[model samples]
Target: MWIKASGRAAMLGLKKKILEQLRGAVEQAQREGALPPGSLPDVEVERPQNPGHGDLATSLPLRAARAFRVSPMAIAEAIASRLPALEELEPVTVAPPGFINFTLRTRWLQEQVHHILSQGEAYGDLELGAGQRVLVEFVSVNPTGPVHVGHVRGAVLGSTLARVLEAAGYRVTREYYVNDSGSQMEVFYRSVWIRYQQVLGRDVEMPPGGYMGTYVVDLAREIHGERGDHFLRLDETEAIREIGEVALERMVQAIREDLGLIGVDFHVWFRERDLYQDSAYQKAMSMIRNGGYVAEREGARWFVSTALGEDKDNVLVRSSGAPTYFASDIAYHYDKFLTRRFERAINIWGADHQGHVSRVKAAVVALGVDPRLLDVIIVQMVTLKRGGEVVRASKRTGELVTLRELVEEVGRDACRYFFSARSADAQMEFDLDLAKRESQENPVYYIQYAHARIAGILRNAREKGLQSEEGDVSLLNTGEEMDLIRKLVLLPELVETVSATLEPHHLAYYALEVATAFHWFYDHCRVIGEDPADQDLVRARLKLVEACRIVLARTLHLMGMTAPQRM
Candidate 1:
């Protein structure tokens, strides 16, 4: 009763009505003596895998043979007999072993097609994640070298996840944590300084642990152009500091551009140096010490992470007074939890960082924040293959491939789609030949082609003046068209599920299905026909095609792909 009266309750009422209808139908069958009074077991209704099975199938009788104390066939017949034959069901059948198969009203699914057309690209959006604030931090690649194909996956995945979260109604912040204070950055600094010395007529050998990438020479050239002869005369550390800042900024810019090619933007660029220099680290040290998480040994400070399940105690501050990376990270989390106050902070890291997970989560927990508030998503490593040969990348050995090179070779959409097409936990191989040669076969292009094809159809239809009519939706009965409409209707449910599970690959898969549906529908049905009788029907089909276009456009846009007007 309350369900019928309240607007919000109306949604629940529909479900209750379903349960009530199933139960009443069973009870009435008992009164008619069609079977024993309680012959049918509890009903279980779920959407069917194949559309021919109807909107939902219930196999309760099969699962409850012992409880019903009867054969499954008898229960299926009992339930079938008692229920009012739903008009939505084409021909409800009872399979052997008591499976109640339903065939949904194609008209209802067809009607949803218009809802999407009316809703435009916002069709699948829901309010499930409203008012929730989530922080997604990823691709905070150390400011050492340019991005590599290895770094591209995390950026694409993180950006895509942030977009998915937003569509599901959460206020999501996409962030990049700059690792400017790390040892790798120092090596990069030294590498550039050595190149700077060489540019200044000083014969200097490449430092043992220096960055050997071609970018080092480019950075030195860039430094030379701007600072002239004066910058070359300074001491190594001083000159490196001046030139390193410029080099780091250039590197960050190059990184930003690489991400921009794929449509990812960070809301914040939290500098790691800020944690150390801005008292955030000191404040965190004080809190952790008070909490008994920090212990001193031989004039050095250590965070007793071993007590918190780490393999060993990690040094917070060394005897020479330099703070370790772990110490700065502790303070970063402290500020993130105590100051930024994200409901949940999700950090996407490579598989190599799996060992760092528990310590970070523990630090958040140790700082009085809920342990569940911190989430670490470790995306597995990516293997790069060129002509079936794996490209071995190592920054220390300077065997790495920069991300800009990958983007330039394969393009951004293909790069993002390929990485996000599989579960992050699964190791992926980036095949250069496949990425570059057969661009049309790329999943991103396939989906984009759907949108572009639809746009072309719409263009052709409009040119023919095929003014769409809001005709009776019942006219839509084609199998492929119905399948496509059904897929569109379930998109909202898919979004909710994908958001909750954090398996963004589901969206990638859905993108492929949606495009496939469009392709099938487009091949079979023409949106514009010359026959007078086919005009209104053609117009109606136009509406459906528009709905598909909207979905395809948004889906590709979310994946950071362009919906080319003409592919």
Candidate 2:
């Protein structure tokens, strides 16, 4: 059941047979003593970054020259003569320093453009993931308040990464961890109480370190419920807990809505309160202590994290016998790895927790879990900018922007695109005005416009009674068309590389490359109203254009971006 040498139908539109031919030829050279046996390292083949250097380039000759005691130029000459032929990759010339550059045959590239049109939406997906299970946890903000813009970047990042992973053949679970413990929850309760009193028309000021947002005011009014007047005289602790519970639920609902607007939907909503109620942390602590991984110091229980590369011991329980936030994390991670047995667990955290990474890893290692099975991605800070001024994240009592507010201003698409457009390890600025623009200056709109244009062309082609069958592949031989073809053909490599690297930004960059190629082809090549002799060429060109559109559509889709058929 071997596949045929179909023109442009080569697997994934690559010259697979030709690559094998080249490999065989190089080996033949070694066998014939034209070059020393095993002189070259593994046939290192690659597409040159700069087109001027030719199609494919390899440094094998130079690498083996010193070992073989022969000049690199001579070694390259021997290999070139014995080299097997390839379809598009014409082994053109050996440059200085043992670089073998290549030139792709125009006919082969033209055929690729045709192949792309014929393939349509099926063009780029190569099924590389083969359906493995991958769980992604992100934007685990406490339910004390609405999600601030500070949390938006990671939300977009994790959701997009999940989409990318799914496209690459992994079944992805997107989860959000709700922190309902620690002093933060207490702060939340207090804020709700203050707001409840305010709603009841009390003259009391908010606590010294408490939220001043109008959201708290809304929560208080909801809780007051005609007892609005009685809330002012109610006991502080009772009022705080009541307000905290109801307010926490409302805030989580708002966050879900905010995420929903941006196309981010989570598979699980895990609460930290559930962990404590189930006694998971107590069991984890007891197991670690009995397992001899915990010790007592200064009347406090400390985990022996130093054995797993941590600098010092971390307190598992304070002298007051209450566990710290780290204790909850240990239990949560244990639940994920030990109880769930999810193959692996992935956490997308914010820059604020940068210091916790090492300790978390150490704890996982100490708990007898393979540290390699844990993946932690920290999203750097994002500064919201409007009118050339830095907008701060309102620290409960200060002026700031919530994620929902930002999404309302620009849009979900712009927010997701802007955040996931760069390396997650670096900080970025969210230009509010620029993202809201309808112009090409707005990248999401720019990419969407390209998709829309192609759709328009196709729709009108049908209405105008144009014969739109995929025309002859031989008609598309121009460099611009071939360039577009080559870029489209590399979709599999792009997806696989980005998935393996865990970098969704690479897919964003690929979208831009495909868009640039299509735009260039669109400007230079006409799609209709030509002479009869050029009729087939028009069809072929349109087909190529359609293929580009499909790729642009799907790549953006994988990124969870809307590829609009019209702006």
Candidate 3:
């Protein structure tokens, strides 16, 4: 049920209202002997795919038919006949195969414009989460280099989901897990040390599989400028350790700045090394071992994943006494679920990490936590294109395109919109030319232009001394007006749907639909006109346009995009 928490009682949206009515009508039918008394199935209400069919439809009768031992059509008719009259809806109708459809009255939708105006920025806010704690961990890219295009998709998804959850009344904590305790950081540290030697005029060959990006050399140069030959005085081991720590700090700072270019910020920057220092790793391993999920094999400790129905067992610690990345993940989740006690933890990882999902869940269960508390969203890679040709590397650095560069070229709004326009499971191609285009073909521009157009109308009204607050929403009776109002009232329900599904791409698509409806309404109606006698109609239309602006702006804000007042 799509319910929102109000002051003392739950505020029911249109979908929830329909569901309640359907359940009540079913009970009334059973009491009146129209249908057999039996257990009722879960009733669900959904928007009809065909607008002409009705606004919302349900299959409750079909679901209950077997239990009641009645024809679905007869059950539907019985339920429809017993339904109480709802002022917000037109007459309920029954369709073939036992579908009950409900359509909102045109006048009801028109009145919602005033309701939206009264709510203002609070129109779409929902309390569905009821103050539960949720940790959204994403973009935990190895702090080896700048944030590349491959990582930005997950970054945007995580940040947008965090925002949507917050608007739905969840206490959300955004986090980035810094993989500083792994072999990758070891390579990054050595790569920086070698680069420092090279910059100081030492002829040295880089290690096998060293970081070859120019950013590493730049890091070496910056270090040399600040502390010239300072590391040369220390022993090589000590010098490497110090240089690696400094390099890691610098890399993480760079990543933070790059993500900030697209409006992503994290409440927590968790270090993998902390798991060892704080004994979280030891605690997690102890719990797993006590649960008999750990075994000794091949001179190393192995996680007995096969016992948990996995195809193969996994090594927890190598023979050399070093923990694997999988071990680090188990410790991290222990901290998330047991130490911090978040009700739910959402991890957004790149597609490359898809294989680790089931194992992580298995590990969580080994630690005595419910596996359902963890959600892993794998975001596929992003392909950059320019003029329909694939763009592989940056022209300036000759490496993967950085998030900063993308934001600089296309602006932050375009970067966020395009990244969020696609589902996390699908690979998306971000077109540079289309993103920067000023025309309607660009969804970012088209949506923002609708808000800008509304702004212009309101500005014109104010200049003419026409007060929209005094307008009668009842005067809004045109088909276009009702259609626009219909779109406007969908925001609250959309918030609940996206919150429940944890899919933020729906918000992006909904924003576009709202923009399309506003554009259609504007083409057919005028909010500001020349004749004095048409002023009443003008005022009413202005109120509706203002409602459109509110909903559109709220949608953009939730997606972390700007609602430009002017093109």
Candidate 4:
């Protein structure tokens, strides 16, 4: 039997459908002159934590009540009465305190299996952005050393956010801002020079606060191997400048390679030196001065942040006549918003830089752009554990744990998944033992197992001459089946939520829910059996399993984790 469009309700997704129903109800009430006329606020719909309340609950009536100057319960009742009949929705109910709850129709729930299969990997994509340009700059670690685990969280967060935005229809640019020009770069250069002299068996005092890691020694050895005793012929000034430039490039390349170990690559490696060389810094400073946001005090150029509600002014240029990092950052952002013309700019910084957030936004506002268009995500530190004991630093490097070592230890999938398993704002402890384990206790294993198990089921079904394209979706009516279908349908809405809120950690939680739903469905519903009378049921369940695979795979891919067909 063919499923007709008239019989199968069109799914606009649960949240969107509920919002439409609420908005339509208000419009209908207005048409009938049953309530005061006014535009409704953006309806916020979410799944009720307690399922008994309803599938989705909203406080739109309470919000609208204020605008219309009426009792919330009365407005809710009027809105409920005026709701148009929707096949996907059973009915809208008014709860206490003006909450509107909506339940899903059984047929509509069952139809989602078809919808998921029809849409496949494209099912969860949303149109929330509608093609806005969003530039996400993250893990812009200074090119002084290798990328350590400290940088891992921000890299994962930014990459996942970029993926989420792309799924939500935003034109995204994954970027890395290279601090290639600064005092740190000079320090790194001198560090390398000192190591070069030491490596050549010369008496040289190591600079104070120089990089002392084994990697620095390795860099010196590399330079020695390439040009033995050649730097001794050059003057100190020439050697410092020439060798520093070479070491900076090498360090940046090393950082890039390390990031690649964990599946991070940037569309643009924006160099800080470019901002100065291109005079973007001069132009930005002039713009701020023209806007009266720049002032000179005590021979130092200061950003007058008090006008933007800051308690004190921040220095842009020091009295010694050298521009501070803050000055370069202002220019970089000016290029981001005005030069590059990105509608929105998102910077992912370490938690230590949280103080810079307000100041940068103040600078953006002073540069004549909306500060709201700039978003700063501060990712807290991550602590790693091995065998229930804290692993503060990598034993091999004798310093912070390099992201490469973490990936080599737990594999890229585990590293990416575990690093992104928590909110960027929250500090997390990564269990090295659990990550390396191949048990269901590990979440990556658990989620990947569902996909692998479904793969096995699909293979068995194929050998038995069963296919979802020929299956009858109506055969899926079990409670477990409906619950799984409902969970699968929530992915698109979840993407929308993450894109709006800039939180990809929600994907991690949602993936676990999907995995749980799949596991539950598998336990209660057997997909393949030899019984001739149950062939239709077997075919339908196979289709459902395939749909689950699509969602599971999409979620994993979105988080930069692999969806393994075999574990």
Each candidate's TM vs. the true structure? 0.88, 0.90, 0.95, 0.93
Cα lDDT listed for each candidate: 0.78, 0.77, 0.88, 0.86
Higher lDDT: candidate 1 or 3?
3
Report residue 400 deviation for candidate 4 (angstroms). 1.4
Could you tell me which residue pairs clash in candidate 4? none
lDDT by residue (tens digit), candidate 2, 441-496:
77777677778888888887788777657577777877788888877777766766
Model 1: how far residue 352 lies from native, Å: 0.6
Residue ranges of candidate 3 with Cα displaced over 4 Å: 1-12, 66-69, 393-398
Q: Which stretches of candidate 4 lie over 4 Å from their true place?
A: 1-14, 23-43, 60-76, 94-98, 393-398
For model 1, the superposed segments whose C-alpha errors exceed 4 Å read 1-52, 58-102, 394-399, 439-441
Order of the predicted models by lDDT, top scorer first:
3, 4, 1, 2
Against the true structure, whose TM-score is highest? 3
TM-score order, best first, reads 3, 4, 2, 1
The residue-by-residue lDDT of candidate 4 on 513-550, one tens digit each, is 99999999989888898798988888788888998999
The alpha-carbon deviation from the true structure for residue 334 of candidate 3, after best TM-score superposition, in angstroms, is 0.9
Query: What is the Å distance of residue 242 in model 2 from its true position?
Result: 3.1
Error of 4 at 539 (Å): 1.8
Error of 4 at 533 (Å): 2.7
Highest-scoring model, lDDT: 3
